[model samples]
Structure formats: structure tokens, C-alpha cells
Target: MSKEAQFSTDKFRLDGKVAIITGGASGLGFNYTKAMLISGAKVVIASYDEKGWDETSKFAKSVNGEVKFIKIDVTAKEAPDIIVNAALSKFQKIDILVNNAGMQRRNNSVPI
Candidate 1:
């Protein structure tokens, strides 16, 4: 039996890659957004929180990476197209996708 090891330095580079993230205004989504930016990836965040959007955009600008926020409800039927188009219009190509938008509601006991 023979063992072989291979490594490529280019695998870690994200230069010229575009990423679209949903629910990226805060929480885990926000963290992922920052990490991607630090790795040299252009990011577009789609969220429903206006204030968070503004703040995240400002923060992203400070980091010197291309970032954009688009207010959208991911539940909407047309949301996918809108997001895809936005990313394409801005960066011309999308190399990654981060679908992180979701919500949960408390459940009440049903009347029997």
C-alpha cells in the first residue's frame, strides 16, 4: 500500500469570488458575513431588518471589502431571483451561496 499527500495553496484564496448570504444582518449570519469578508470574498446580505442592514453595511465598508445589503423577505416567491440578480449585477458572477434566513414561532397547545 502507498500513501500520498497533496496540497494546493490556491484552495484557501477567495479573491474575485462573490457570496450571497441571507439573514446576514445579525447573529450567526453576521459572523459568517464577517468571516467571508476577511477571506477576501465579496458579500451581499439580504435581510428584513432595516437598522441592522444599515449598521452591517457601515461595518462592512470599514473593513474595506465590497458589501451590500438588500431588504427582502426570503419567504417571498420572487426573493430568490431578486437576490441572484442583485449579486450578479454587482459582481457579475456568484461563486457561493449562504441561505441562512429562517424563523421559528412558539407553539400553543391545541384545543381538543
Candidate 2:
């Protein structure tokens, strides 16, 4: 009897794909970046905080993942161009884009 192939995250593999993840330097965005890398996709992390890049870089290296990063506020008018250019410059083509960049400000704490 022929052996059946196993169903796993391999079914969701993104080999040879390139992705741009906004806010990928921290929070939920960071998790998305890690997952994409593990799935064989090269990732470009676009974030507002430059400091997060270092941390993301460390994790990428530990996983032997291919990653690049750019620091720019997603709210800027030129952000789209900047991010697209950055991704194209390194990976040549973009296959996936994660629009995960945003910010929030709390004016008051909840009453106990």
C-alpha cells in the first residue's frame, strides 16, 4: 500500500514567497513574521519602532530565517512607497503583504 502524505503546516508553506509585514517588530505582528519565516517565506518587517528591529533580527537568526527590516511610520503618506521599494530592493518580488501596522493611545484607565 502506498503511504499517505501527512497534513501539517507544510500545507500552508510559503516557499519562494516574499512578505511585507507592517508592525512586525513587536506584538502580534512579530508573531506573524516568525510564522512566515518558518514557513519558508522571506520577510521584510516594517515598523515604527527601530529598536524592535534588533530583537526581531535576533529571533530570525536563531531560526535561520531570511529577514529584513525598515523603520517608517505606516501613517505617513510616503509609507506605502517606502515599504514597497524596500521589499522590492531586497527580494525583487512581493507575494504577501500583512497590513498589521497601527497605533492607539489611551486617554484614561478603566475605573476599578
Candidate 3:
């Protein structure tokens, strides 16, 4: 069989799998989204940034894969539930979840 056929076997195929990726609008998260799509996984990328959200949505469309963007602040108490619901509403099931949302600010000195 051909390479594509080999990869399409049950073990390698993610045809019915659903993946939720946070911070997926750009950088490392974007790459993860693309990889999951190429592997046949439906992906939902959540982000609070509007510009990044729009750009990511456009890119996802070009790939012809099932992708969606849900505006959310990861730090919020209800954000996780909201994201989970959105993914389920779109794809019906969630097979994988990539929690890549968070921010880190630099602190030059420590105060005692």
C-alpha cells in the first residue's frame, strides 16, 4: 500500500477524534493546531486576543479542516466549561485537550 494508505489505518488515523487547543491563535499553539488538523483531528482554538483569533481562523479555513475560535479568558472560572461546551457543540465529542493557555511576566527583582 502507499504511504497515505498506511497512515490511514485505525491506529494512525484520528478521523473521529476531537482536539481542544488553548492559546492556539499563534506561536507554539498555532503549530499544534496545524499538526492536529493534518492528523485528521477536529480542533477548537480558544483565545482572548481578537486580531490573533481572526488570523488563526483565516489560516485554519485555508487548511480545509474543521476549526473554530472561541473568545475566552483562561483565568476565568467559567472559561473551561465554556470551551468544553463549545467543542462538544461543534464536534460532539472531545478525544484530546491541549491546555496551552497562560501568560508570564518578568520580574527583575524579588522583594522580601
Alpha-carbon local distance difference test for all models: 0.81, 0.85, 0.79
Q: Which runs in model 1 stand beyond 4 Å of their true positions?
A: 1-11, 106-112
As a whole number from 0 to 100, the lDDT of residue 76 in candidate 2 is 89
Give the distance in Å from residue 64's predicted Cα in candidate 3 to where it truly belongs. 1.9
RMSD of 3: 5.5
Model 3 whole-model lDDT (C-alpha atoms): 0.79
- Cα distance off (Å), candidate 3, residue 45: 0.9
CA deviation > 4 Å runs, candidate 3: 1-12, 106-112
TM-score of 1: 0.78
Task: Please write out the lDDT profile of model 2 over residues 54-110, one tens digit for every residue.
Answer: 878887888678898887888889999999998999999999999998766677754
Pairs in steric clash, model 3: none
What order do you get sorting by TM-score, best first? 2, 1, 3
Comparing 1 and 3 on lDDT, the stronger one: 1
Give the lDDT of residue 13 in candidate 3: 59
Q: Please give the range of 10 consecutive residues that has the lowest summed lDDT in model 2.
A: 1-10
TM-scores for all predictions: 0.78, 0.81, 0.76
